[model samples]
Target: MHPAALAGATLGRLAHHAVSGLVGAALLRGASKAAPKAKPATRKAVVGGLAGGIVAARWLGSAAEEARLKAGDMLAEARSSLGEEAPPPSAVDIGGHDHDHEH
Candidate 1:
């Protein structure tokens, strides 16, 4: 086999073994716990993970919307000043209207 291919295969196997070992250790630890059978969904880790995910999603969505609005405004401004000529595709105006579209 090629040297690079051999290295990649070895790395892949090592990663797989490492991940499997970690998962097995975690599962064994959980099985060994003597705690009473509590509801799985009520775990603190699960709730915290869910809340963090929701917050991240909202933040990303708001940021994307803000960026889009800013782009639109830049396009409108460019169109107003450039006038009649077709603005470059990358151009943004002060308002978000398409330069080619009739008002």
Candidate 2:
């Protein structure tokens, strides 16, 4: 990937993480204020939710990465089958247009 695009993707992920954290903190604060006596339970719930989210994210992320690799492999296989000098997905045009129409 181009450096700029890679940087943008990295920054995007960082932004998402930062926002998620801020939102989580706000939720915990609200929960604590909403139920003064149930602070312990609220804390427990928040912790559980955060843990569950982390687990789910990891599972889903791995699954997605695997899928992407499989897809790339399939693409390369198909191109070779077609006697192609076809470029990899990343090497395709960045103009948001389908290059498959020619193939």
lDDT of each: 0.81, 0.89
lDDT of 2 at 103: 35
Best by lDDT: 2
lDDT for model 2: 0.89
**Which whole-number lDDT from 0 to 100 does residue 25 have in model 1?**
92
Least accurate stretch of 10 residues (summed lDDT) in model 1? 34-43
Which prediction has the highest TM-score against the true structure? Answer: 1
Off by over 4 Å in 2: 1-34, 86-103
Q: What lDDT is reached at residue 85 by model 1?
A: 59
Tell me how many clashing residue pairs each candidate has. 12, 0
Per-model RMSD to reference: 8.4, 17.2
Candidate 2 C-alpha lDDT tens digits along 3-103 = 99999999999999999999999998887678988878878999999999999999999999999989988888898999996585677666766666763
Q: Write the per-residue lDDT of candidate 1 for residues 1-103, one digit (tens) a residue.
A: 9999999999999999999999999987886573346546447768999999999999999999999878877877877787755456567456765579665
